[model samples]
Structure formats: structure tokens, C-alpha cells
Target: MVEIVPYENCYLSGIVDMILSIQRDEFQIDITLDDQPDLLDIPAFYQKGSGNFWMALKGSEVIGTVSLLDIGGGKAALRKMFVKQSFRGAQRGVAGCLLKTLLTWSASIGISDVYLGTTTAFLAAHRFYEKNGFLEILETELPPSFPKMSVDTKFYRQMIKPSYVLPKRADLEGKK
Candidate 1:
């Protein structure tokens, strides 16, 4: 079973490994963690105001990640959305679960908009965002605070409203 939960200090290494594996080995993106400071200090970068990071864990393995960065003015930026190729697709639903986790958190925290930037090479990513109600937008449309990566050429946004947060299995079972 896969569980979606918030980022914890102990899970940092797992999160970093998951992202780097996907970006380097799967996507062949020539980027290093050094160039992306946020991944190094997730709490300082993402755990403020309406921001948060989430991971999809199966057993003790981190298989997916998603982040919502509070950018002020009722807006947030989506970042670090990656799922291990083996756990992707409808059967596993790791990506969907991670996205739903972030969107649910965004709604709870009054985030009105969520934006994301991806590389043109991420064709599946573009489709995933679009399927999840994110509209494709020009680079010029992104907010000034949106962190644009060097390889990012495609951008997307999703307007959000407060909605129901599905209860977790623990919640249903009356576990803390």
C-alpha cells in the first residue's frame, strides 16, 4: 500500500534520491541538486505559510513527491512532482495521489492558484497537468515569484477553491 504524507526530516534522503533518480536516469535531465537549493532545505523553502511538501511511500520506500510553494497574493507554485516510473499509471496511482495531496493542502490553506513549470521534454508531465485541470499558459503569464528552472519551457496553472479533504485510512480507522 502507498501512503501519502507530509515531508519529515528523516525522509529527506529518500525524497532527494527519488527525484534525482527520475530526473537523471529516467528523464535524462542534466541538472544537479547543487543547482536546486530548495531540494537541500525543503523545510526552509517549502514549509512556510501555505507551502508544504508531500511524499508517496510504499513500505519504507519513497516513490513520489510533490510540493506547493506559497508565493503570496493567494498564489502558490507547484514543484518537484515526480513518481518512480515503476509506480506510475492508473494501476499504481502514485502521481495522482501525490497531486491530490498537494491540491487538498492548497485548498485548506486558502491558496487560490497553483502554478508549475516543466521542461518541454516532459511530455507526459504536460499531459498529466492538463488532465488534472491545469491549463497550459505562456511563460510570460507566470508570476514574478514563480521559480523558473533553466530547462523549464512549459508552464501550467490551476485555479483552486476550497474543497473536501478525503479522509485517510487512519482517519477512517480512528487512528491518530
Candidate 2:
């Protein structure tokens, strides 16, 4: 079984290793930990204000991650979404679980819009975002405070309704 939980100090190394491996090894993205300073201090970067990070763990092993960084004024930027290659796809549901957890937290904190930036290389991610109600958006559509990464050519936005419900199995059923 898998467990989805808030970021803990003990899992810092696990989270960094898992994400770096998937980004560099699995996706062949020519990036390093130096390029992602957030990984070095998850609590300082994401755990303040309305933002937070989560981990998908199977036993003590980190399998996936997602984070919501509150840009301010009930808006947020979704970041650091990565799942292990072997644990991906609908059957595995690791990605969905991480997303569900983030969305649920967003709703709880009165977050109105969740925005994300991704690279063109993640075609599967584009489809997944669309399936989950995130519409493709232009860079200009982003909020002034939205943190746009250099590699982020594709962007998406998902609006959270006032009466948000933790999505049914379809939104992320059988996840985790």
C-alpha cells in the first residue's frame, strides 16, 4: 500500500533522490539538484503560508511528490509534480494521489485558482492535466506573481469551485 502524507524532515533526502532520478534519469532532463534550490529546503520554500509539499511513500521509499506554492491572494502555483516511472499510469495511481492531495489542500485554504508550468517533453502530463480539468493556458494568462521557470513552455490552470469536493474515484479514485 502507498501512503500520502505531508512533507517530513526525515524524508528530505528520499524526496530529493526520487525526484532527481525521475527528472534526470527517466525523463532525460539535463538538470541537477543545483538547478532546483527548493529541494534543498522543502520546509522553508513550501511549508510556509498556505503552501505545502507532499510525498507518496511505499514503506520508507519515496515514490512521488507534488507541491502547492501560494503565490498570494488565494492563488497558487503547482510545482514539483513527479512520479516514479514504474509507479506511473492509471493502474498505479501515484500521480493522481499526489494531485488529489494538493487539490484537497487548496480547497481547504480557499485557493481559487491553481496554475502550473510544464515542459513540452511531458506529453503524458498534458493529457493528464486535461483529463483532470486543467485547461491549457498561455504564459500571459498567468498571474503576475506566478513563478515561471525557464523550461516551462506549456502552462495549465484549474479553477477550484467554492463547494469543492474531494473528487470521486474518477477525479482520483483508487489512488494511493
For model 2, what is the C-alpha lDDT against the true structure? Answer: 0.92
lDDT of 2 by residue, 1-176 (tens): 99999999999898899888878887788888999998999999999999999999999999999999999999999999988888989999999999999998888879999999999999999999999999999999999999998789999999987554567887586676
Candidate 1: segments with Cα more than 4 A from true spot: 164-176
Q: Per model, state how many residue pairs clash.
A: 0, 1
Please list all clashing residue pairs in model 1, or write none if there are none. none
lDDT of each: 0.90, 0.92
Tens digits of per-residue lDDT, candidate 1, 56-92, equal 9999899899999999999999999998888988788
Write down the RMSD of candidate 1 (Cα, Å). Answer: 5.6
- lDDT at residue 116 of model 1 (Cα atoms): 95
- Winning candidate number (lDDT): 2
lDDT at residue 30 of model 2 (Cα atoms): 86
